[model samples]
Target: MSQNYPQLDQATRDELVRAYIAIQQIYEEKGSIPKDSETILKRYQGLLETLGAIHLGLLVASFSIVLNFFIVNYILHLLP
Candidate 1:
């Protein structure tokens, strides 16, 4: 059986690629250095925060788009 997944737009795909590259670079750097759990944890935390912010921003943007659509339609219906 085959499963189909929704496609991401170019901008979203680029953002995901950038995030993946950043994570890979961090791992590469860590491998070359003496193990420092604190630093690695901090780096992961920072990345998680940044990704969380991006997710929040996208959520707000989507909500605003939907709200605007409803608001505009409501206004249009109000016009004689």
Candidate 2:
């Protein structure tokens, strides 16, 4: 990815490389979120937020379907 940032100064590129190493170390050791991951995630918050909204919608739809099934089977005695 640094190849894509040819215009970046050496110091800036070094910082980014260090950040990637830190991030990789955290992920490898914990198998979960790393400390200060919010800094990275914030960079792509718009895309992440959109994905979160879609996930929430799917969860709610699934719950609604389950609730409807219960209503039909128990409340309305429509299923055996």
TM-score, candidate 1, is 0.47
Prediction-by-prediction clash tally = 0, 0
Give the clashing pairs for model 2.
none
Residue 10 Cα positional deviation in candidate 2, in Å, after optimal superposition: 30
Compute the lDDT of residue 7 as modeled in candidate 2: 87
lDDT for model 2: 0.85
Deviating ranges (above 4 Å) for candidate 1: 1-43
lDDT value for model 1? 0.80
C-alpha TM-score for every candidate: 0.47, 0.46
What Cα-based lDDT does every candidate model obtain? Answer: 0.80, 0.85
**Winner by TM-score:** 1
Tens-digit lDDT track for model 1 on 1-80?
A: 01232476667777888998788778878795444545766778979899999999999999999999999999999999
For candidate 2, write residues 6-53 as lDDT tens digits.
Answer: 889999888989999998888868967655656767888999999999
